[model samples]
Target: MDVMVPRVAALPAAMELLDRLHDQHGPLMMHQSGGCCDGSSPMCYPQGEFIVGDREVLLGVLDLRLFTGQVRPDAPEDADGVPVWISAQQFDAWQHTQLVLDVVPGRGAGFSLEGPEGVRFLTRSRVFNESEVRALAQQPVLTGADWDTGARPPAATRPQVVTDVADACAIPGG
Candidate 1:
């Protein structure tokens, strides 16, 4: 089988933060915001805290080895690493580059779990060269069903919020 390149990747510093967050938060996930205002920054949250919708996408998952001393309550006794996610639309624009999730000391404006730690997560990117782009082109891109039930609207379709199970079911193949 061919190995696929991930749409999102983390640096060691970001992994360290993820390890610390996982120690306290149990498990974690990230969402890359596409709206204005702190939207450009990726927000980290305790798993399932945020309501993922069709507008969002799962860019990739990160496996940050549990380096923190505390074992999360929900983690298996012998759990190895934690998982993280990124938004799909954000990935479309950034597909040609590699994302490096990092942390810097500063207060971030958003509900991201890390905001209270006096630090926030940031993304650093580098463009993919021809070879890397070619390799990435061969990889399968993640869609809504691959990560969650929410189905993104077609590019020509306007997006709407699914307020309840009924609304979610109303979506085509949602």
Candidate 2:
């Protein structure tokens, strides 16, 4: 199935959260739970690992290690017939925290964004169902998935220079 990379437009709330994360934590990693075609959500590694589906995407950035993987199309169906993508272990770790998936529709093409908060609609071309949102939110990560254990490296140290290039290039007498 053809998968598309979703475009992220952080809303005020999302942007605030992102800034808070950057200021307190570090870079952000993303993942997703649901989408079209076999109902598989493709895992994307934007900075680290960002998962993308036909209509949803997830963005994550944390100090803890987390499991991740792609959802199988033929996976066993939940009570609602929507397949489970993410694994149980991952769910336990992410429990209590709300994950949001944003959906966007384009001309014959569309994408979604999923994170630990609310979902944002990107485009007006496509339609989605409540079940679809739940399915996407329910996507799972692989058991024993890799995690980011190391702390984000400190921002590059500013170098000490003898002279400023711009000032040095200025006309001496001018």
Candidate 3:
């Protein structure tokens, strides 16, 4: 019964990306996965391909596919293997947010984008620093080394696992 919508602050960027996608792909849905804090970030899809009721928007030249999901949370620690933890409540809140955007060409065979407002300049190149790729791979949504290959792993893989060790401390003869 919990209806999760993208935070309203992301609307402008989402709308812009949606329009650009429509212009390029002629109304289709654009799907993109990857984020800093959550599992899946926002990406745009062309109009008809991802029909939101009856509105069709376009980007410059790329078609988009719209899929709903949460943004990938930031790595707990930087690539240095530091420890990080986001509370379950905070994570749950983020899980309900949505993003909309289109992928654009990068300088050296990579991609950039028009993401949520202040984040429009965000960009990534085909060549990733060894550490950057490693950090991204740590996300449940990205499995193995295939993340760098432009393959979307799966949403079901993002759940965090926790194990209680108290039972292991039971005394045999206390």
lDDT winner: 1
| Top model number, TM-score | 1
TM-score of every candidate relative to the true structure = 0.71, 0.22, 0.24
For the record, the alpha-carbon RMSD of candidate 3 to the native fold, in angstroms, is: 19.0
110-172 in candidate 3: lDDT tens per residue? 122233323432211122235544543454432223333534322222211111212212234
- 10 residues in a row with least lDDT, candidate 2: 76-85
* lDDT of candidate 1 over 1-174, digit per residue (tens): 254555566655676777778778867878776667895887888777887654455555565442333444665642423334456656677777766677789988989888888999887665666877888777656555554643321121111112233322233455
- Compared with the true structure, the alpha-carbon lDDT of candidate 2 equals 0.29
Deviation in Å, model 1, residue 31 alpha carbon? 0.9
Winner on lDDT between 1 and 2 is 1
Off by over 4 Å in 2: 1-6, 35-174
Query: Order the candidates by TM-score, highest first — what do you get?
Result: 1, 3, 2
